[model samples]
Target: MVPITRTVPAPSSVRTARAPRRVTRPAIPGVVLAVIGLGAMAVVSLWWRDTPVIHGFGAMLTGAGQVLGLLSGYGFVVLVALMARLPPLERGIGADRLARWHAMGGRYVISLVTGHVLAITWGYAVTAHESVTSEAVTLLTSYPDVLMATVAWFLLLGIAAFSARAARRRLAYETWYYAHLYTYLAIALAFSHQFADGASFAGNLAARVAWSSLYALIGGLIAWYRLVTPLLMFARHRFTVAGVRPEAPGIVSVYITGRDLDALGAEPGQFFRWRFLARSLAWQSHPYSLSAMPRPDMMRITVKARGDHSGSLSSLRPGTRVIAEGPYGAFTPALSGRRVLLVAGGVGITPIRAMFAALPRRMSEGITLIYRASNPRDIVFRQELDAIAADRGAVVHYVVGSRARLGYDPLSALYLRAMVPGLHRYEAYVCGPAGMTRAVVAALRASGLRRRRIHHETFDF
Candidate 1:
């Protein structure tokens, strides 16, 4: 357990830059298959309009089945992940990966619904031999199942619409979470429509098997992710608040120690959205990185009291029961090989601190830290940072924002620019406020750093 150490160079200069584009297309094989399958079905339904009504109905049913099957699988995973129900062995995917899946699944589900709408319109056109819109309205109004499907379609649409960053930015995580919870109800409606009226499963034994198999798979996955995993956790570690101390003004650090944390199988630089039973903080959980390396015996999370729920965290008793909903991010230091550049702002220092502490003291890899805070008092782990640097020659630079004579420009871009002389040759780690991380990332890329070389932890965004 020897610590890594190396001589670090002084940072070069600072630059101000805009936030980089954070949007990425999440990879989802199931969703991709559904999109392709639905598109093919749409074509078949449209082309068979003049054929027998049974033929067109059959095509639409097949497409609907494929789309529903795919969406159900991915959606089930998301539900389990959000609920902290996934088994320890299977819950390795972090928030970044989850968000990517969510985005891809969302797009695919919309595409499937769009295909469903188009195919149904064609079916109506062939059956009524008139305006399909009129027939669609008729179907929607006449059948309860059809009505439910339409309602579910609208709900899915709403969820997808608000899932966008622009809309999500305006809502609190709790509101966004609750609003999105309707996804289950929407899917239930979809299930009813599929079983009750879907031609694929109506009278066919194979289709019945297919539907039954889908239910079993989705059901088993749900049980594994939600009920079984949580039950096992409650039986084992059963977390209770060990202590809550203010590490800095308006910043409280909650200490939690439990059995079986070694079995929790988390790494340094990851975070959890913590829940406390206190009435003031119970409604929503807040994401906080383990401020120090987890040592099986105890875990520490440093949280800044920025919002109503977070602000009241200090009021909780030491013995309060707590539920941690994560270990849900992927900013671990394992991916890098060259020297590491760790950057933080305000409360953003937690994950970086963990990585710093976790590294061996004499391992010869270079490390540099650029920590920005409002003032001297706002810094968390100030003594720890000093001690680590003193022991290992880890270069530590502090940017006191409010005290700067240049009138407190956001130091994120500046820090990145200052470090850029050799940064392109090393790995970059950033965790902090979204604005700061964005600015730094943009600055690095604008200066021609490769995107792969820049690594970051998941934050509130």
Candidate 2:
């Protein structure tokens, strides 16, 4: 294991006074859900008011299509808003949970769109005494914005296909990220078609205005949070690459130097979407957790060579400009119990390592960290971890070995109970690869911890 040292002094640009306390708002998620539910109710009411009577099968199908289209449009707004990188939602709800919601919501919205297209085409065909295929062609050729809508539908379908687990695994991270940006174009095309042909909006100024307002609100949020905020942060902080130090064979820590970094309010377990302004790296931004505590003028993020983007960070030159978009995620020690248990697997040790150092100095109970690695050499920051554990009077356990060599999984429920008695009383924080994280979480639950007591975040998305 490589030894590391921290001797950098606080820069003059940072405030000498204490940092302000962060106010935690736990009700943001519930409030957001309530707002979504209200919007859905309004959509249903609009359909109910506009669609009073249904006499024939064709009318019924058309009505169903209209309802589906309305809900889907509203859903698109909600979907984009969820991922707008808004601080409240990102910090309050956590990025991982929001990502899960966005993914599941995308599937539902796609299904609704597919059903709308089929039902509308078939219903129009029956009403006009024509075949489904004929009606579809006619709609595309004759209806205002219908061709654009059709194009948008196909784009959405393609995106959904690529977003699947298997497809995502085959594609590079950059490709997947850039492909998802086409969602903005698809939503714009769909919006035009909605106003052009929607029954509820036909000659209804109030309905059109309301729908337009909703879109504008969500668009404004995306513009401000995703675009404007980052620009402002970049200009204010003027971040740059200070240096990069190798930790292991394929892992290195990037030290970022900036102005007034403390003003960014980054906690130990939070992360930033880092965009390095350099050849082949300027266009893509990747999320990397801070491996150490934030300083007034510097911060550190440890990256493992998991992919092309991460692998290339080893070559980053000092003084390279950097654009960061966050201090996001809610995985800090604020939510942990008196007696805390920290679990880390492989590169997941980055965030866990930071939190371990930040744990309260005097705990009534104690703090324990279990690091799972495939081998002794794979253990990162070993010297630093031992130093912190000894200085803080915390316990550090390194579980090193492959499953085959060990003859069993060391992180199983039975083993966890033997390793740490009364595991249920401690709040656990886990970070690691998706498979290992899931296994550890399952083991923790089985060992008597409640779901709420265990916190974890995966970067698989």
Candidate 3:
């Protein structure tokens, strides 16, 4: 790889020319969906007025229970819908944003369900003039679906406990992911009781049909996107491993070949959740970004051994079948400005490498890549990156060294502006570990780039 050594002469200190601000609408639809969910729960509460109420503590408790139950049911549907992998919502709202919403919403739904259980049990005890324990036993025995729902409640509670940050840190991604499959069963068992035993739902035919429809629609979406779509693509493409070659220590590139590869509609700078159907790896899947421009019948992904699953990607046998889940993500060339700067850290260089291959070029050089690694020996794809830079005259800067405290960092505001002639006009794409990403983003902002001009591909689960 050719090292960057030439420096643009700095006659004076940096002069900042800010890019004009551009407003974004990525979150508008997501916000509207959230508002509608809250409002729908509010409307569900109105159904309670149609029933007779005792004018005492029992009545208040009963009403609270009904409202909480309503909120949880609504939340369950929305939570599943958000993760159903609906292309429009995922592309518009962003996969990272949707994942955050799903996780946060899960916490609230669990709380609401807990409140519903306690309030309803206490309210029923008061209404029946019985001890809380006996009333709970009676209700559980009397309701047709309550027993299943109780078990479902525990399952949801367990999932919530497993999802805690501390718990997640101890588990492998495969374990954490398989544990999430129980969520579908929990949702089914928990929702069954709403129509069968719900006081507010007893006489409301319209509400029953509406609730049923919501669940059915969400179920259909999940079935299509999560199961059916990928199976169809796998059958059609028949992707198989072609070769595996080492790029650097602990890093390897996997090449895959398939039929009519163009039909996948894969754009550069996108990724797939890949499942290699070989011994011990038949069911587990992990996301990896395309590391090279897509060829009509083949594609390539570079993987660094980061975990048990990732470490196994190097020894895949030739002809092992592959199942892929996407061309999903908005990190393509369409998001670039007239001038573009790409910042990559460690294995984060995967998508940026593909983008560099495909991003539109200006007559004058328009692409700048700043790759950060611990040292020169750790820089993956050095030869290919150099080839692209030399062929296209794109600027390449390798920031390599141990993490050291310094006021004069190469990625600091002044240095970034000095490297790129029109830094303010450049759209910056950053991908790195969380800490490094934050630092680079701050430097880009200080270099006079607007918020809308900075794009980062977020792969955090």
Clashes of each: 16, 0, 0
For candidate 1, the per-residue lDDT at 338 reads 46
lDDT of 3 at 410: 69
Q: What does each candidate score in C-alpha RMSD?
A: 8.5, 3.0, 7.2
- Which pairs of residues collide in candidate 3? none
* lDDT digits (tens) for residues 1-461 of candidate 3: 22112221211101211111232436656575777667675657655565575689987888788888888888888888888888866656657667888999899999999999999899989988989999889879997799888998999999998899999989988788888889999988988798887877788888788888988999999999989999999989988887777778888878788888766777666788899998988878788888864555677888989887789988787788999988776565544356778899989899888877665445235878999888677798777777767766788989887567433576778777887778888888888787778888998898889997887775667
Candidate 3 regions exceeding 4 Å error are: 1-54, 129-131, 363-365, 405-415
Task: Report the error of model 2 at residue 191, Å.
Answer: 1.3
Instruction: Please provide, for model 2 over 1-461, each residue's C-alpha lDDT reduced to its tens digit, 9 standing for 90 to 100.
Output: 33333333422111222222343437777888899899999998998988869979889889999999999999999999999998988888889989988999999999999999999999898888899999999999999999999899999999999999899999998888889999999999888999899998997899999999999999999999888988999999999988787788899988888999877887767899999999899988899998876677888899999888899999898889999999999777664357889999999998888787766665536688999999887888887888778766888889999999999999999998888888889889899889989999999999889987898988777
As for TM-score, the candidate ahead, 1 or 3, is 3
C-alpha local distance difference test of each model: 0.64, 0.86, 0.78
TM-score, model 2 to reference: 0.94
Stretch of 10 with least lDDT, candidate 2? 11-20
- Compose the digit string of candidate 1's lDDT tens values, residues 1-461: 11112121111101111111222324343454465457446434433442334455645554554344434433543443433434332234456555666577577657767676666666555656757778778878875588887888889889888888889888877788898879878877777676676544455566557555755666676776554654466568777777777777888777776776656666667776677878777667677777754445466777787677777777777667777755656566653354667888888898887777655544235778889887788987777787776666678888775635656464545556675456666667888777778877777676666887787754665
lDDT winner between 1 and 3, please give it. 3
Give me the runs in candidate 2 sitting further than 4 Å from their true place.
Answer: 1-27
Assess candidate 1 and give its lDDT: 0.64
